[model samples]
Structures are given as C-alpha cells and as structure tokens.
Target: MVSSDESLPQRLPPIDRALDRYPYCIVWTPIPVLTWIFPFIGHMGICMSNGVIRDFAGPYLVTEDNMAFGRPTRYLRLNPKNVDGGSSAWDEGVSKASVLYGTRMHNIFCDNCHSHVATALCNMHYENRTSWNMIILCFWMFVCGKYVNVCGFVKSWLPFLIFISIVVLMAVYF
Candidate 1:
C-alpha cells in the first residue's frame, strides 16, 4: 500500500503542476512572416491536455494541431490557484468558446489568434484576461522602441509609431 503523496508525481515546478491540474493551457509561438519584421508578433493558443492546440489559424478556420505556429515558445498557466483543486467545469466552457470562435471568421487586427486564446481564458473565468493586450503592446514597444524610459510614453505614442511603421512598410514594399 502507498501513501497518496507517493502516488503523485514529485518535484514539478509550479507552472508544470498547474498545467497538469488545469483543463487548458495558453501557449505562444512566433508568427512566421510577422516575426521576421517584429519578433514580438507571435501566435497564442489554448492547448488541451492531450497536446491538441486550438487556435485561430485563419479566416473561417479554428484549427486543432500539434504545431500551430511551429513549437510553442512559452506556456502560460490559466489559473494558478486552481492548480491544487482541479476543476473540470471550466473545460466545457473553454471548449464551447473554442468551437464558437473556430466557426467564425478571423480578423488580423481584431479577431486573431490572441483573441481566440483570450476568449477561451475568459470563458474559463481566468482573472488575468488582459494578457493578450499586454503581449501586443509589449511587442510593439520592443520593435519600435517608442518609450525607453517611460511607460506613459509607450501608452501615449506606441499606437502612432505602429501606424507610421505600417504605412511606411506598406508604401515601400507594396
């Protein structure tokens, strides 16, 4: 006879433990063409326990693939507090949201991969739902270097910088 603790896997990191207990995981990987110009423009997905990733691949297609945008560079835990408790309730919620978005049309600026992940997390009632917005903003700051010292500067000027860069790049190449 073995103790309950002995039966469970040992020495896992907090995030790893969370992944094992949670129904879904958020993952990030670089978008091929976009990463060439802006390394920060990456794709986000909700990875189920079976290693199937649900992501917005393109318009009218929410895909479940092993390698959505190559291998994932990062895995973000959905809810850290729920790591020990282990709830299955959110699983159906996330799955329903995924199917809903999967059938809808995709939009680059508005309804893209990050939005898909965000919506899933939101359905799960995850607290830190602003992560998607932060990811985009941080990447824009990284690429444009709009605000080196001030957060306010980035908040104020990053949009204009992004707009200018897009217009300039479009004019030059297309």
Candidate 2:
C-alpha cells in the first residue's frame, strides 16, 4: 500500500523568495497617465523586506506601501555590505535617515522621491553616490524635455532645431 504522505503534491515556495537575497532595493515604475510626456521620467522607491516600499509620494508625506508602484520594473541594490558599519548598523542608519526626511517638501529640481531613496542609501556612508547623481541627471533630462515628436521638437531638440531654423532663414534671405 502507498503511504498517504507520498500521495500529496509538493508545494512550491513563494515567488518573492528570490528577493530575499536583496534586503534593500530601489524600485522603479513608469509615470502613470503621463508616459508620453515623460517616458523616461518614472517613479522610484526604496523596497524593504516583505515587499514594503518607502517613497516620497507627495509634499510632506513619505509613505510605506506594498508593491507601491504595481510591481517594480527594476530593482537596484544599495550594497548594504559596503556601509562602514555592519549590516544591522547600516539598517538602523538608513531607518533613521528615512525618518529624518519623511516630512520633507518634495521638489522636482531639489528634494524629490529619488532624493529620498538616495539620502537613505547615502546615510550609510558607503562612498558610492552614483545613485544621487543619476537622480539629478534624470531630473535635468526631464526638465529639458527630451522627445522625438513635432510638438516637442523645440524643447527636446532645441540646439538642433535652432541650427536648422537658422539655416533655413539664411537660405531664404541669401
């Protein structure tokens, strides 16, 4: 006779189990309803264990939500091991940093959501501030308005459009 336990099917582990290796991660998501105007300008948040995400959703508000951006398109690890202190100490430092900026004003050019995550990561003093620079570059690109369309030609391709316009004017006049 077959044993009862052998008749049962094996249960699979949770899909998020793979994420355990990354205790902290940067989550990215497309801008809702404004993807056309800002295709590359997406939202960013810090992902904690068990799918919790901390993000500066708006002015004076930092929220922790589950799967905050409806499943992040990417996960950028902050390299906790690189912190001057141990992992636990680093975690505490990040937590304290988050609390400090939790009620900060959100600004596009200055203190935005990306800044929130970057500040938290930087609190560990890991000596890698690339993420902060990346955020600033992304913000600048968004403000400059990069695109490939007629309406955005001036804002997106200002230098090229100006040069072409000048050439056309010279040809028409002389």
| lDDT of each residue in 63-135, candidate 1, tens digit only | 7764366555555544434433234534554577688886888787888777776666555555534344435
Residue-level lDDT tens digits of model 2 in 4-63: 875876332222523422255566555554443445566666655334567777777777
Q: Which is the leading candidate under lDDT?
A: 1
Q: Name the weakest run of 10 consecutive residues (lDDT summed) in model 1.
A: 13-22
TM-score of 2: 0.56
lDDT score, candidate 1, position 59:
75
Q: lDDT per model, in order?
A: 0.56, 0.56
What TM value does model 1 have?
0.56
> Residue 51's C-alpha lDDT in candidate 1?
44
Error of 2 at 106 (Å): 1.6
Pairs that collide in candidate 1 are: none
> What stretches of model 2 exceed 4 Å from their correct place?
1-22, 49-51, 66-69, 128-174
RMSD of each: 9.9, 11.6
